[model samples]
Target: MKLTKTLTSLLLAGTMMLPGAAMAETTLNFVSWQVGEKGYGDWWNAVIAEFEATHPDVKIDFTLVPRDGYTDAMITQFAAGAPPDIVHLTSFEYQTFADNGWLEDLGPWIEKSGMDLDGWAGQGACVWKGTTNCIMLLYFGYIMAYNEQLLEEGGVAVPTTWDEYLAAARATTFDRDGDGIKDVYGTGVHLATANSSYTNDVLIYVLSAGGRWTNKDGQVTINTPETIEGINRWRTIVEEELTPMGMVGGDIDQLFMEGKVALRIQGPWINGFVQRAEPGIKEHLKYAASPLQPPLGGSSNVITLASETPQEKKELAWEFIQLATSQKFQELYSELGASPAPRPGAVNEAAFAAVPHMQLLIDATNAASAAGVDRIPTGLEAQNNEFAKVAAEEFQRMLIEKLPTEETAAAIQAEAEMLQ
Candidate 1:
């Protein structure tokens, strides 16, 4: 009777364990490239804390990879089948991952999340083909960083037209003290970092000149006359004493902060850095629209995001993203001087009113957002980077050395084809 009773208890215990006694824990690993202090990772940490507190059943492990060699680490992790549940995909690398089928489709999650992305351009950056592939969490517009004092000193009005922009660049440029050396430059070009975004920015010039980078059918259209015009206009900015070449690395931002350059095209983050890192620089800073149309004609803004992400995480990721970019968070970002998204009517009026010059940035982002156009699958972000380097360097040769326009255009077309 004792042995039978014990056997009965053991059988029951085994049955309970088979059904529900052993509960499994779901843990997610998130990897991002922003590892430095106050980087995106810092903000993500706060967001994760909130998520975990609300959902105690789930666990999240967040890791930030160094910005340098970030991609290599990601590939290694992926190869081992221990890829992080979530990864940060920048506009520069989105295509490569997506094309490889490494990402999960998040369309179902997006449909279920019921998040309102109407005002935000997040959808544009997150969508691939007809499917929504990624969730956009952050956005900032690229605009011309101008020197208010330099414009005032030169008696040059803020330029609105491309022609005027070129003239202003020339007027503001000079060897101020006549030391027989060019002490100041009117404008600057990014030659050092070799970032491919320059191609996108330069494409803005082509767009303003009424040129297209790709056809509606998805073909490269860079060799057209309008493109040639845009490229030539950029060259003039370099050779005609408007903007100078050789401003690479972070030199452009540094020079602009030091008031050596009158105008530069950069993001709002630089503005925030100036406010904290170099307080005096703030007094001279102002925001202006890109000369989309030649000396000053480009008037559009372009914002970029990455689309290669797994579907399962994209929704949750976007939730985190939405929280990060929500109007409330955007207001905080604006206060911190990080260029907030241009949701015009979406901005908090009271908060913006209290922050001086932030309104200008808001206005700039508005213009950029309105003018922002999406470039679909311009090739793998990696390929895009190479093409951009080729284009920027070619333009530099034309601007700095006055290389033949035809030759530069030809080279751009050739290299761009290789990317395709």
Candidate 2:
């Protein structure tokens, strides 16, 4: 009996040492493209820490899938029915997952928790097939990052309209040190590609001119006069040789960071990149509202619970979602990411102190949300990638061929209609 008792005690001790004895550490597999990004990474780490604090037995295994690989990897995992417990999806691509019913219906949880989603930026995008499938995490309007030294030396006031902006670009596009080569340019654009890398840069032009890629009703409105006007505005800048055309978004960002470019219309990530600008450039970097009202940049990213998530992990995943979308984390997102949170009023004094132009981004997001504007077309939510690609390709063709704005708009309209 003594030997048996000793053996039992040893077994119990060994089991205790092996973990999952008193309380098994339930790990929620989480993956994201932002896990390693500078500001966004910090925000996510803090959120995970806060979640872990409340649920000591829970561990969030955060993994980084680089941006280029993110969408494909996510699609493969979800299609294989082994999606991460915590699914992080981009707004444009979330439709595919939601459409396939790979994401859980979050409505029951919201109702049970009495969560109020009113005026939530990008919330509308989460309503797919009459179910709230995801909680939107990020949305933004374009902000113009400018070089103060370049603007002042160009002898132009800050531009509040496209015309003035053109003037600024013209004045700033000159060679310094008389190198006889035009070394400095006014702007940079990702106009040589198809899809989001090029779409966003061109979309802003259309959206700012009181136009849209598609109306709220999902009609192809690109052929409208407003769209033509916006195209003209963009073309004018290009014709004047104001922008270093054919560069990708990253190259443009790098040029801005090096103080080689005067201005750039960018999303919230710009502030973070600017902070690391090459030596003399960081101090002179300033932000302003893009020339016109920034259209709702729409849902950039969202968090969702996988529909096939294990029953045991469902509540835990929801809890994590709740924590992520909580006001505290939203506020932290604004402060740490230097990006506006989808949650209104997230850009409070605390966030403003840490992030430059917090109020501008917040207010823009709020106004766009209030107006029910989203960069995604109303009818083509599920077909966003296709629609955006068509739009981008047509726009690139127009620029390369120097086609008239009318022709460009017509081409985009015809191609967009095919998607519908």
Candidate 3:
């Protein structure tokens, strides 16, 4: 009797274990630059946790590749024919992957699932080569972060026009304590970093000056009168020493957080750093609308599945994506990410009361979408990285060599046209 009971208990235990073992069979890998980041990381984790709960058998293995190296790392994976199950790409870089067929097209899946994608912010950015290759999940606009105390001391208000902005920068940029050395810089821009970031920041001026990197026809327009005016404005700021020389974005951001820099323009993500700023400085930091018209912002990032992801795994990944795009998560994005969520009507006014600047961010996003602005040059989307480098080099030349703005513009124009 004892032996029979023992065998029966063992069988029950094994049966119980078998179900759980079977349930935990699937593992999906997700890679992104935002993993472990302040707001974006939390949102990603919450969505993944709920997704695993809903689909008991699946686990998401999250990895963080720093933004500076993300493009190369992802390219290496796809080249090896074993990319991550979940692929997250930045706005200007996804087209290269789509062109190479490394991304899974979701048209048939969307049809089968009957997902409603109408009026989705940045939805049009996902359409590549007549197919939906990814979801543009993080379209955003740039905002100006300014030091309230510094502006008060300088006797200036938040600027609402480019000329006013220049005047404000001039007032705040000065040598503190009567020292010959410059102490407080007026603005922070990515000058030495020489990447898409520089392009993005400078283009804010270019667009505001009534110029574009390229026209709708995909020809270089940097040498035009309006464009040169904008380029000269950037030259004026740097030449006048309103901003520090030879600093990358990271250094500049650190300086801004430390209260050494008075004003800076960046995407909504800057809010996260603002919250973590030093106690005395954080309270005085405020956000405002940029003087730049049609802010240099749109389609910041996208999420897609790898073409090499197995069919069953792809189905599971798609479910995870569905959760990410659902209304609940969309609301979470607005609250947690502190930026305008891509979904229409996702932002909560009450939730955004703590960060009053978000109202302007929303307005900026709407204006940019209506203006049809993009960070990457129109015809050079695939070669965006190269274009950025070229522009940065010429910009640095104009700053370092004190080359004439018109000459620098012509150089950028000639080099950019060669990319074709």
Candidate 4:
């Protein structure tokens, strides 16, 4: 009787094992640009942990690639018909992917799943032709970090208008050694490439001057009178007013580190680096909102996200993106002083609580978010950058060498047509 009971128990165990074997495992692969940097991969891991905990039947696999080759790598993977289950797409690169029919239509997913994409600042960037191919994960703003002591020494008030900014730039620049040659520059011009890489600041300038890149019909309207004038103004700043820093396309981040430049229009990622590099400069540092046109006619500042992802994974990508761009995550990032939230309400309370001056930035973000629009980052991105480069270089050459404005404007126009 004991032997019979043992055989019956063995048979039951075998039957239970069959069901376990039949259960299928679902694994989702996520690709992002986070290979070399330490602590950068933490967010992805945290999200994965949260996702795995909630969905026990599914698994997540993360693939970190270098930021330099991120877009190319994604393209290669997507072309193989085995793209990742999720991808990080920048606003600037989204256009190329959308143009190629590589992305999935996320409109149905958002409508059916009831995701809260409306509150995010980057929602516009994710939408192409009224369809969302990817969800925005974060918002990064670029501002000029100024040296307070130097400003006071130069008797300059913090600039609010373009005129004030130009004057401040002039006052900030002077030869410290009393030599005929000017040794120090008041403003730094990041005259690298003009593409999406080099145009964020210019975008701020153009928009502040009431320039628009496109009409409601999604046609390229880059050659408008206001745009031409805006480009001319940028050229003037680079050529005649500010000292040229000559930072390469990808080297702007490093240039701001040395603190040699008095005013650097750069991103928030450099905040911690500056504090660590020159602890004494903490009290002396201040951030300025990008300049607005006088008489209150400045358009909102916008950002470009570059990404290449496929359709099937877009739904999951949006969920992951929502998590990354949520108010909770934005505050977490703010606490670390990495970057601020893309949305107006997100991270603002904590940001203002941490630093009073941050209120201005938050206000600006709110205003901009309310007014901003999203456009495709066409393949013309490279052309635009090259055109800006030529114009900037020419403006610099003319200003430093005292060339004519008409000649500079002509060169800028000629180069701009090539971008079309």
Candidate 5:
């Protein structure tokens, strides 16, 4: 009888320890498009490792989806009641997910957690319907990146105004070799169909011309005279062959890095590519504010509202979000040369001290208009995406087929009005 009681007691003790051990460990699923990219991937992995070190029981299961289908993938997963614990949301997708009731309202949590929002540069982009749904990770704005050596060789000064920009383009666009073909181009015009670059590139001109696609009342106003002038300016560039033909945003950046293009409008992230490609090339690369208004671009992180997630997992996921937006990670973001951190003080001063030119790019972030808000009203992601597709198609016709700008603008306005 004594031996039997002892064995039973020992078994019960072991059983009790099992639940305790299970309670100590948690695994969270984090989904983002940055997992495999160069600077972004490195920064994310480093932060994850640090978070795991402090919270020994938590494991982050990172899932990387390509940018092309990231939104659709998350939506599908959420519909099936198996969404990732954390989601990376772009400005265009934020309102759609929030309006669909697929994202957690993080206002109360942020208040409870004491996450400061005042210093973030693009904080306005993450709030919807008076609820804070996401937090800004990085704030990217459009800027002019030029090859200093090319400008110098062509005796062209960096353009400060629209007329100057056009003059510089004409001056620098010439055949370096007498091969009867132009070996270099002055700039690039992104006219690809069904792409955000087309919309953003157009926005730079539209906003610069004091024309906006939509007004404060959420109305579509694409056919205004200012907008017409903007489109005409872009058409002139195409007609004059100042920029390379059949090039998109990516092509512009690549050509700029290869020293084939004299100037291009790109985000701060391009500096990282320039630094990595050829260290000495940094001396030749320079950045300036766009000749007109700068378009805002970047993404935020949010927690998803999917079924079957344990409360502990939710808490752990929230902790990860807090850590990500913390000053330490923000500084890491700057140190890695990803983009300017959303928070004001997070741009690692020491790192920028070494590369002073980056401070100018960071300063340019102040000039950025709110990403989707400046272009369209809140809660119009689906409409905006559709409109972007139609607009890109029409704009391509204008650029490639030599269609009249007025005709193209009217067609674009018709499609946009359908959305309204």
Candidate 6:
């Protein structure tokens, strides 16, 4: 009887120990394209460390995907029924994912937590069919970065209007070594169709001219007078030989660093690239808001629907998203990435004080309009890609085939209507 009692006592002790020893732990997978990028990777690691410290039972499994194949990889993973719990998707990809019901609707969580969304730059991109599906982490607006030395040599001040921009470009383009061949161009233009840069660059021109791809009701409005005017203006720049021919976005950056381009329209990432490639050129770099209102640029963090199977895991994923979008993390992101924060007032003033040129980017974001991709209806990723493809082809024709601006605009509009 005593031996039986001792066994019972041992069993009770084992149960007590098991309750504490078998503590449930959750692990979340986070996928991002910025894993090895200079400042971005370090900042993300720091955030993960802090989050892990607070939630000791939770482990974050980070997966780094290269930018070139990131979207395809994410899609493949989702199709395989094993998407990461959290994802960083670009604005262009957000709507498609939300439309397919692949993303979690964050509205209820935000409402329950009473998270304020006011004054968050580029937040409109996260809303799909009146449901918030993502949280914007980075916000960038198009701005013009000029080489001060080139502008000074050409005796031209910074251009603020379309006409002035053309004049400056004309003045800045010339032969430097008297070789009778122009060695430097006034601006670096990207017209390739393999990437989205062509579409984005063209949209900047269209948006600045007060043209839009669609109306508030989502009708096709690409063949408007304003759009034609914008396209014509762009053609004139090329016709005047102000930009190098057949270049892509990466080539533009290279030309700018080599001092072959006097002015280039780019986002905040240019600052980091310039600092790393040509630090000496930093002294001559000056930034200005795009001649007209620029398009918004950035990405957002989203929770995937795969996490919904388990309520606890879903809640934990949401917690991480909240932590990432919190003001503290936003400030850290802006400081380290040199990009503008998604939310206004989330940037550290002292950080910008050291790089005053970045202030122009902040101001531009405040004054910018939504990008073309953001303005389209949800679930139209395929249609959108088709539209971009057609538009890019027509744009290339305008540049190389010398197609008339009206014809190009009409072609794009017809393609857009066909998709509709």
145-250, model 4: which lDDT tens digit per residue? 7777767767888887778877877887776778876555556655644334445455556666666555455445555677656656666667664655566523
| lDDT by residue for model 3 (244-265), tens | 8778776787788888888888
User: lDDT for each of the candidates?
Assistant: 0.59, 0.80, 0.84, 0.56, 0.72, 0.71
Residue 34 lDDT in candidate 6: 74
lDDT of model 5 at residue 26?
67
Q: Pick the candidate with the highest lDDT.
A: 3
Cα RMSD, each candidate: 7.7, 4.7, 5.1, 7.6, 5.5, 6.1
Sort every candidate by lDDT, greatest first: 3, 2, 5, 6, 1, 4
| Residue runs of model 4 more than 4 Å from their true location after superposition | 1-73, 80-84, 139-142, 174-184, 215-225, 267-276, 293-319, 325-327, 333-345, 369-420
Count clashing residue pairs in model 4: 15
List the pairs of residues colliding in candidate 6: none
Error of 1 at 157 (Å): 1.9
Q: Give the least accurate 10-residue stretch of model 1, judged by summed lDDT.
A: 294-303
In model 6, what lDDT does residue 274 have? 62
- Return the TM-score for each candidate structure: 0.72, 0.88, 0.91, 0.68, 0.84, 0.81
In the range 1-420, model 2's lDDT, one tens digit per residue, is 345747755766677887567644789999987876778888889989989998876899999897655777998998898999999888778888887888888898899988889979778778888888888888876678899999999998878888788888898998877978777888877765577667666667777687887887788788898878877777787777788767777777888888888988887887767978877788898988777565536678888889898977998988888888889988989899998788877777888899758877866666666656676777788887788778787777777787787987888788778877
* Candidate 6 regions with alpha-carbon error over 4 angstroms: 1-27, 38-42, 53-69, 112-114, 174-183, 239-241, 293-313, 369-382
| Clashing residue pairs found in predicted model 3 | none
154: Cα error in model 4, Å? 3.0
Ranking by TM-score: 3, 2, 5, 6, 1, 4
- State the lDDT of candidate 5 residue by residue for 58-92, as single tens digits: 78999888766667787788778887877677766
Please give the range of 10 consecutive residues that has the lowest summed lDDT in model 4. 294-303
- Which model, 1 or 4, shows the larger lDDT? 1
Task: Quote model 1's TM-score.
Answer: 0.72
Winner on lDDT (2 vs 4): 2
